[model samples]
Target: MDNHDLKEDPRLPYRATSRMEVVDVPTIAFLAATGEGDPNTSPLYADVVEALYASSYGVRAVAIEELGRKHTVAPLEGRWWADDLRVFSARDKDAWHWQMMIAQPPWVTVDVVTAGIERARSRRDLAEGGRVTFTTVTEGLAVQTLHVGPYDAEGPTIARMHDEFMPQHGYRPRGAHHEIYLSDARRTAPERLRTILRQPVEQSEPQS
Candidate 1:
């Protein structure tokens, strides 16, 4: 069986550069869980991530054994926001809201994913698994750039995009901050970690 990987998938713009560029992101389905708190320190965040992976692996098993399909688990992605945008710049993670996700192929139906979650639940007490749901998002137009180094050091790049590039290009932010984790934090060095920073945008109206 062929191994399907998101990194190799042309449909996903997983490859990015330090240069900012505009891209149209198509609607994609995901197994996702939403919560609020610091990803670095929140217990809920850890549980959510564990639940996502467990469920995704479970889904892969069902797909290969029962549906005759096999694929590598996709990268972890997130959409983050806060009641006050300043909280992000201030590094006040406790005030953040986020949705963490793992992509799923079209063939993985909701029922199949549910079964996967059920399998995970049978083995461990992942109450967060119950929060996982099959969902989709359409981020039509967006600007993206590659960010390297520790996740905490992204402020400058993000400020440039939102404060300088967007205004200069007549675009305005439209959605929550999105990030695709391209490097595994568990095995990769923090300074070498790769992440794709994406933000949905819309054309700004001309002032009268």
Candidate 2:
């Protein structure tokens, strides 16, 4: 059987331009783990991400064995927020709360995820695996843009999205700031990395 690829799905937008655009996102499920702190320096972040990947691969293994099919594991994605929205513009990494996840194919249900977690626990140091859960997120109306460069350099683009674009377009931020890592940081140069920056939004009430 041919391996399924999430990137080919229209619901999953892997390619985007630097220009900001509006898109309607459908409800999607993910294997997710939530935590706080600087992703670059926090050990918790590292552990959670490892757990997500391990569980994802485990799910793929289970699928191949039980369903006789396989899928290309999607890229790592994140949802970020903080007590104060300004922290994002200030680049306060330590104050950030985040959920890192890997989107699974629709065929991978809750039972499959549970089985995957169990399998991963037996083979890896997934002290954080228990934190990983199958969750669905409905972004609905959202604005997104492709950000090219280092992770730290994304602040300006994000600011433009939240402070300028949203207001100009009569929308308000409604959910966590989201990011899709399209390039592997380990091998890609900081200047060449590509990321999709997204924010869920709602139409603003008309001024009195």
Candidate 3:
């Protein structure tokens, strides 16, 4: 059986150059959990991460054993926002609200996800297990870039994208900020971490 991998799929906008690029994003399914607070200090964040990966791997096992198919689990991704956008620029981690997720293959269905949850539950108790749910996100027109450094350093890059690039190009930010973690933070050095930062946008209307 052929292995399905999201990074290698041309239809998906998985590749991003260091320079910002605008692209139209289609609807994509994800196993997601939403929470608030700093990921480094929040217990909820840790629990959600554990639950997401457990469920994802469980689903992969089921696919291989029962359906005769295999797939590489996609990397972690996030949708971030807050009551005040300034909080992000100021690095106020406590005020952040985020949905942490992992992209699932197109063939994965509700039943498959449920079975995967069951499999994870059987192996170990996941406190946030119930919070993990299947969701589809349609970001539409978006601008993205590859950020290679510590997550904290992304502030300047994001500022440029939102305050300069978007406005200069006649685009307006429309949705929550997004990110794809291409490198495992636990094992990768902070300076070498690869994160894809994306923001949904819409064309600005002409002046009256």
Q: By TM-score, who's the top model here?
A: 3
Q: Every model's Cα RMSD, please?
A: 1.1, 1.0, 0.9
Give the per-residue lDDT of model 2 (tens digit) for 93-119: 999999998998888888888888888
Candidate 2 positional error at 117, Å? 1.3
TM-score of candidate 1 against the unseen true structure: 0.96
Tens-digit lDDT string for candidate 3 (142-167): 99999999999999999889998999
TM-score of each: 0.96, 0.97, 0.97
Between prediction 2 and prediction 3, which has the larger lDDT? 3
Best by lDDT: 3
Please write out the lDDT profile of model 1 over residues 1-208, one tens digit for every residue: 8888867878877789999999998889899999998899989999999999999999999988889998899999999998766566566888889999999987899888988988888988896988999999889899999999999988888888888898999999887989999999999999999999999999999989
Off by over 4 Å in 1: none
Clashing pairs in 1: none
In model 2, what are the clashing residue pairs, if there are any?
Answer: none
Instruction: Sort the predicted structures by TM-score, highest score first.
Output: 3, 2, 1
Q: Tell me the whole-model lDDT of each prediction, alpha carbons only.
A: 0.90, 0.90, 0.92
lDDT of 3: 0.92
